[model samples]
Target: MAIIPFNKPYLTGKETAYICQAVESGKISGNGGFTKKCQAFFEKRYGFKKCLLTTSCTDALEMAAILCNIQPGDEVIVPSYTFVSSALAFIRQGAKIVFADSYFDNPNIDADKIEQLITSKTKVIVPVHYAGVACNMDKIMEIAGKYGLFVVEDAAQAIDSYYKERPLGSIGHFAAFSFHETKNVISGEGGMLVINDEQFINRAEIIWEKGTNRAEFFRGEVNKYGWVDTGSSFLPSEIVAAFLYAQLENLDEIQKKRKEIWNYYKCLISNTIENYQLPTIPYFATNNAHMFYLICPDLSFRTKLLQKFKDNEVLAVFHYLSLHKSSYYKDKHDGRELPNADKYSDCLVRLPLYYELSDKQVEYIVSLLNY
Candidate 1:
């Protein structure tokens, strides 16, 4: 039996061609031709004020932390059900992570619960677009505006997803996107920091260029590059940009295939809701088909279903373990209890979702669910 893996990175052949051109053109370093091409592509496509490629989404997040002036003792509101990068990025910058609760249906931070946790020390609100589903950005933004807080979107899974026809990354003051192999786009390990606010563009470039006026020097705006502020080596090699440009060029095709698989799963199991609850898509959000997950009745049922998949040579898996429940953050958790986030952390099971998934494989996977 052929084992169906949970995720597979898809690539278009344009990489080698671009990489060859990059090498032949004699500039295969950071912020070279391929890198600039990707930056321009993302900025034009997403309406980002500025976009900088980084070594990883984690790096982009750290840059955002610095740009936002996250300081020691400053509280940043984030969901406890998201990837550790969402909280740890700020935590590394000496900000205290104020863990929030998840929404009832998705892993996104519940916007309704944000205000009650606010304090004079609160500085930023990090919202992860879990499973490529948009959170209630309007509610989140309104709260941020009212409280004078910065909104940083942890849009690692939301490259092609949208919120109210506006692109996900453009809605927040700063947004971090991943190009890791597991994401819709693949460069093995890469990320982008998007600046939506105009005021942050110059500083963002400086942060990406290791605190030097290198970007200005390259543009002839500065006679020579000079160190100006504290920064790190966040830029990726041209090889990563080469691979990523290929994926970005084929973004529509990849998204088309993934959506087909996602819809197929939804159609196959839609009728099964009488026995098991299926994944719910909010009417307000347009998803990018990043992941297709189902909600079992309980944690035990989800675990059993996963075992059944393992027995059948299908690599089904569960998503995140709520961050608040982790040993590192247990003491840091807010006193308020979050039943929905806890329930989702226990019951959600993500099935295999990738661009190359065939219709026959989809049918076989769904058929096993009926057993």
Candidate 2:
């Protein structure tokens, strides 16, 4: 039996050529030619206000934290069903996390409950776009406006996704995207911080340049670069940016292939499966094919399905454990219970859906699951 992975990165034939060009250009450092190309590509492609590539989504989120002025005792709202970096970035800036409950049908934070969690100290609302499906951004923005809070979208899985015709990353005050190997696009490990608010662009450039006004200096806007503020080395090497440029160039093709496989799985198993639910497409959200998942009957059933996949030389996997229930956060959770988050975290199973996966393979996997 062939081993089908939970996810696999695809290379679009241009990676080696671009890397060689970068090497020959004698600018293999950060913010080189290739990096500029990638940044420009994103700015034009997504209509982002200002896009700056970072070493990883973790770094981009950290940049958002800085831009939002996250401080000690400040509170930030986040969903418990997302990756730790989604919340930990702000937490590292000394903000207290207020874990939000997930929507009944999706892992995104419930927008209706957001207003109830806002307090005087609530500084930001971080919404994670789980599995490429957008959260209710309109409601979130309304709530933020009412409370004077910042919105930082964790759009790691939502590169090509849209919410009511607005691009996912462009809707938030600040947005972070991932180009990790497992994502629809691959840069081995890379990310981008998108600033929609004009006020954040200057400071964000300084933050990306290790607390220096070096970017302005490079562009001849300043005579000399000096230490401006607190920052870190968040930029990636030119090599990674070169690879990412190749991926960006092929974004449409990559998304198309992934969607094909996702649709195949849905069509093959929708009629045969029982006690399991296929991923839903809300009327307001457009797909980017970031993930294809199923809701199992329970935690035990999810585990059994994963083991069954393993036995068949496939690698379907489960998602996060609710952050609120984790030992690290449970004691400090202030007695809040995220019931919906807890339920999805325990029962969600993600099947393999990658750009290079074949339709026949998807059918075979779905057939096995039905069996």
Candidate 3:
């Protein structure tokens, strides 16, 4: 028996060639030719007001936390079912995290419950698009407008995905995207921050360049660059940007193949599986086929399901443990029971659905589930 791994990053065959060209061009530093090209590609394609390439999605979230002006004792609402970066970014800014629950039917933040979480100290809502599915952005935006709160979309899994006709990253005031090897697109480890509000664009660039007007100075808008605010080194080298650009150039082909894999998995599983809930892509969201996941009936069932994979020489995986219940945050939580989030934490299982996963493998996995 051969093992089918959970994930395998697909390369476009141009990554090293672009990296070599970038190396030969004599600028391997950040914000050079390749960086600009990647940024321009996103802005033009997504209609983002401004785009900045960052070292990772975590860095992009950190930049969003800064742009939101989070302060000590401020509050940020984040879904408990999300990765820690969604909450940790605001927490680093000295903001208190108010963990929200996921919807009973899906892993998105329960939008209807968002208002109850808002308070005088509330400053931002960090919505993570779990598995690349959109949260209810319309409701979220309405709540934000009513309370004068900022929205920083954690679009790490949502590259090339959409909310209605609008791109996922463009709907929020600020959005962060991941280009981790595990994602549909691969640059080893890279990300982007999108600013939809015009007012924050200048400050965003300053923040991206380590709190200096260096970007302006270099563009001839200023005579000298000086440190004027707080920031850190968030830029990735041109080598990373070059690799990312190569991936970006093949976005359509990559997406098409990924979607094909995802569809095949869904078709096979629907015919064979009877006890698990498949991933849900809402009517308002476009699936990017970032990953395919299942919700077992209970934790015991999920444990058995994972063991079955091991017995069959396959590797499926569980997703996030609810941040509210994690060792670090359990005591800090406000004590409201987030049943749905905890349920997902205990029972969600993600199967292999990468660009390279084959139809035969999908059939085998589904057959195993049926057995």
Candidate 4:
């Protein structure tokens, strides 16, 4: 039997060529020609008001935190089931993290419960679009509007996915996207910050350039650049941008193949598993097939299933131990019992669903699950 890893990064055959081009252009540092191309590609394709590539989605989230001007004592509401970056970004800016629970049917933040969590100190609402599935954005945005709060969408797994007719990253005041190897798009590691509010655009560029006005200086809009604000080295190098542009060029084809693989797994397991729940895309959301996960009835069953996969030389994995219950944050939590978040944290198991995973491999993995 062959060992099947949980994820294998895909390439479009143009990554090396683009990297060579970027190298020959003589500017390999952050924010060069290739970086502009990648930024322009997203801005044009997604209708994002402004897009800036970052070293990682975490960096993008951090940038959003700065743009929101999160201050000490300010509170940010985040779903407990999400990756730590969603909360850590604001937490770094001295914001209090108020973890919310997931909806019982899905791993998205319970939008209905958001209002009650809002206090006078609430500064922002961070929504993580798990597995590229959109949360109830309309409700989230409405809640944000009602309280004059900002929204930073943690769209790490939501590239090319949509909520209703709006693009996932375009709905929020600021959004962060990932190009990590495990995501639908791969650039080894990369990310982007989408600025939808025009008020933040000028400052965002300065922030991307390590708190300097160098971007304007480069464009001849200024004679010289100087440090104008507090920021850091957040932009990705041209090499990273070049690789991401290669992936962007083939986004449609990649999405199509990934969706096919995702559907095959769903079809195979829909009726075979007695006590497992598969991923669901609400009517208002479009699937980008970033991952295919199962919710086992309990942690013990999930553990057995994972061991079974390992015994068969296949790799399956779990995701996101609830951050509210994490050793670092548990004591800080306000004693709210987030049952649904903990439930998903213990029961969710992600199967192999990469661009290169073949139909035969999918069948074999499903066979192991059925056994």
Which one wins on lDDT? 4
Ordered from best to worst lDDT, the candidate numbers read 4, 3, 2, 1
Q: Write the per-residue lDDT of candidate 4 for residues 164-225, one digit (tens) a residue.
A: 98899999999999999999988888899999999999899998888999989998999999
Residue-by-residue lDDT tens digits, candidate 3, 1-371: 47999998888899999999999999999999999999999999989999999999999999999999999999999999999999998889999999999999899999999999999999999899999999999999999999999999999999999998899999889999999999988789999999999999999999999999999999999999999988889999999999999999999999999999899888887876789999988899999999899999999999998999999989999999999988988998999999999999998999987877888888888887864
lDDT minimum window of 10 residues, candidate 2 = 362-371
Decoy 4 TM-score against native:
0.99
Candidate 1 vs candidate 2: which has greater TM-score?
2
Candidate 1 to truth, TM: 0.97
- Clash pairs of candidate 4? none
Better of 1 and 3 by lDDT: 3
User: All models: lDDT?
Assistant: 0.89, 0.90, 0.93, 0.94
Regions more than 4 Å wrong, model 3: none
Clashing pairs counted in every model? 0, 0, 0, 0
Q: Scored by Cα lDDT, where does model 4 land?
A: 0.94
Question: What TM-score do all the candidates reach, one by one?
Answer: 0.97, 0.98, 0.99, 0.99
Per-residue lDDT for 108-153 in model 2, tens only?
Answer: 8899999999889999999999998989999999999988999999
Worst 10 residues of 4 by lDDT: 271-280
lDDT, model 3: 0.93
Displacement of the residue 241 alpha carbon in candidate 1, Å: 0.3
RMSD of 4: 0.8
